[model samples]
Target: MDEAPKALQRFLAPFMEQLTQKNLGNAVELMNEDERNEFDRLLGLATEPVRSFAPYTF
Candidate 1:
């Protein structure tokens, strides 16, 4: 992120905001069953929970 320039960051700000806050269900309501299934599958990958581990000290 440090390498990303301020201009690019400014451009991405609004798109990122929409992505974080948009309701997936509302956006997918018009999709056909197959399209909906594909969306669900992809969304599952993105939403998968990451496991956290406690820090180990030397």
Candidate 2:
């Protein structure tokens, strides 16, 4: 259960490193600050729990 971060890092670190290594800053710069903030907010919400009946099932 606890290895999630390591597993994610293993999968994502290379892509992130490649992005930095390749300097994808232009794509990043294309997004306005407000858009970036909104995207981040949506991403955080996406990672959070939503109302569901699954937990009550037996």
Candidate 1 TM-score to native: 0.43
lDDT of each: 0.52, 0.50
Q: Kindly give the stretch of ten consecutive residues in candidate 1 with the minimal lDDT sum.
A: 1-10
Off by over 4 Å in 2: 1-27, 49-58
Model 1 spans with C-alpha error above 4 angstroms: 1-23, 53-58
Q: Least accurate stretch of 10 residues (summed lDDT) in model 2?
A: 1-10
Using TM-score, give the best candidate's number.
Answer: 1
lDDT of 1: 0.52
Q: What is the lDDT of residue 53 in candidate 2?
A: 69
Clash-forming residue pairs, model 1: none
